[model samples]
Target: MKPTRCPWRGWLMLCLVWASGSASAALPIEHWTQPNGARVYLVRSDSLPMLDVQIDVDGGSRRDPPAQAGLAAATALLLTQGVQASPAGPALDENAVVEAWADLGAQFGASAGSDRLSIQLRTLTQPDVLDAAVALASRQLAAPAWADPVWARERARLTAAWREAQTRPDTWAGRRFADAVYRSHPYGQEARPETWAAIDTAALRDFYRRHARPCDARITLVGALDRASATRVVDRLLAGWANHGCTALPAVPEVAPLTRPERVQLPFAAAQAQVLVGQPGIARDDPDFLAILVGNHILGGGGFTSRLMQELREKRGLTYGVFSQFSPGRHAGAFSVSVQTRPDQADQAVELIHSELRRFVEQGPTEQELAEAQAALVNGFALRLDSNRKLLDNVAALAWHGLPLDYLDRWTAQVGAIDRDRIVRAWQRVLHPDRLVTVVVGATP
Candidate 1:
């Protein structure tokens, strides 16, 4: 699981490369449903001696009860740390579980996120090892130990970690940025000291039971297994699963827009001011997603060649680097621009950001800029799916988010179809330069 308050990494890049004639063979994503109502997606690849299987549910931090912010993450971590029981075998505990997989030369890892909780296993393609790994996964999902001692230790560890996070400048900036941009939305919620204190073992269990439903989850498998064999493995492993469902979390409310330009100042005396700008962005299913991707690259999602980088770093040397991202979740996601600069330059940074955003909305990307961005997006897009694990993540996201199966195949086509007019029009619809939220931590008075 992630160790920090903010787990999302900046996505998109400048100079994203596209090799004009390069062709990528589309891997078929096999889809099916288990009797227990779990949706499954599979892609068999014999290229590796190993197989990667991932189980994802919609039990992300967004499901954390307002009173107990870290409950979702704690439950995810405690799964591997406790006893897991299969239908007929003796229960396996933390160490035993680790040794069992090690004995088979396989790896088991899991983490919870803002959108989902995932347990991933990597094992050599031996039939016995694969079978055991799948069985172990099912057990972990169906029956985590839910023991008091394990909960106590994890709670203490998380409390200490979050308490310490408060002392760091980066953490300070992130917390303020999230609060300012997301306002009352769950996406802005972070685990505070009191949030930790309120979450006991019972809270964790209840949160897990209600939100971690297999019926509400998607299973993705990649590497070294055919449809028939994989089907048998999944069916047997998850046979004990039941379709009993629980109450669903409130539908994520519509993300509120910034009614006016507001700047939040956090008193951190670090050398540079951390400025984050912008507001809610397109969602995964938003038709504008591809266009936003292409346009954002030209704006700031692209690394150095992005307009923000060009303005903030290349032209003024106000910061070493500045980047932007369109972070999509179950609901509308956030679109933000961030940079760290000399504390004294905070005002200038914010002004420059607004100026560039104004120009971007009014003028849009140039033909040369769009062409370069498209090339980079198309080229980098192939590399993003080059590995089995990457393929599993990409496909699992699609399966979980209910995007069309052909979404991957259509990715490049969509990126190619994005033009200056569409890009400009998207920015105009999605962003309001005057209504953006600004967070300046460590700024000079």
Candidate 2:
């Protein structure tokens, strides 16, 4: 029997099926252990023909040996410079592997944060491309060549970069803010010229061996791939890599509340002062985190609707933008309000921010404000899953923080349940406006 299809009706049916399918599709999360005792999270999505592989080692700058402060950062950066398989012969340079990866439309980049060192690769999902990426990453991870010439060049480059950072107002403000908040903890130390100078090839090798191990690492896979195929890719590429079985470093010391105001002045002719103000806040697992987040949004975390933005930008035209964020590290992290305003208005801007913060602490946000904040947060929560990359980020963060598998499913509900009283109490518990550390770069007062 010949079936006649109506073109318009068929298209409508197809659209309905696709919409229903997408609606029913769960965020696919598959976890498995590798032979080397490493944990891997696989997120399978065929939305795009790309793959993102992220390897997170437990040691970052916080694990830097006492003397070699920047060792972790330097080692993470140099991981892909060259490997034993692609060592620099007489003619080839150590950067040969790095250049090769670039030429192949693959990028190998690493970042050092408070808790972990992350190495990420983004590449197409073709079998050959994926194979090359995996091989390249495996070689870089397992057997970094750390050629002397390349080390020397990179060290010089980093030293110069560090020197340059010292002169930048934003850099100065961030470094000062971190130092002020963490205060004598390894988390406080900024990479300096002396620290970069201390990093030698031997030191880098020791740092890498101690920290970058399969046992001490976790892998996150995202983008267009299936679980079965992604598992095979990770296993074949990373399974044979040996684990060094290194112990985790001692936890960062709890940051005591800032006793007094601390300030740093960076000399610059810029029109606006870069102001950073805050102290250490809650960890990721804190039950009151959502309430505090909502409170902060009303206070300064929300862009235009926040109190700080209203007081500084909307009402008084003091600054272009003012915002606050609470960055939750493995340990306690910073809760900061940042603003940039003309130097003459710096003191006024700081005072207005403080006034709003105090109001939040004392009076708390109104029920209407809280409701709006929660609604916005809950409504926007799904946007985090709009892309595979973002979903992978959430997966990585969840795995890193030991969050439950159903964390995302419950996130919006939890946020939506936060009430005005809860937000007020959370604000009072976590924020001490009076004890905040303020860094003003390019301002005298």
- Top candidate when judged by lDDT against the true structure: 1
Q: Which parts of model 1 have CA positions greater than 4 angstroms off?
A: 1-25, 84-87, 245-249
- Candidate 1 residue lDDT tens string, 25-125: 39788899876777889887765546677888778888787888877788788877765555557787777877666555566777888888887877666
lDDT of each: 0.77, 0.75
Backbone clashes in model 2, listed as residue pairs = none
Clash pairs detected, candidate 1: 13-302, 14-302, 14-303, 16-376, 17-376, 18-375
Candidate 2 Cα lDDT to native? 0.75
lDDT tens readout by residue for model 2, 151-270: 788888988888787767888789889988988777777777677777888888877776766776688887678877877767755653556555665666665777776756665677
lDDT, model 1: 0.77
> Lowest summed lDDT over 10 consecutive residues: which window, candidate 1?
7-16
Error of 1 at 18 (Å): 24
Clashes of each: 6, 0
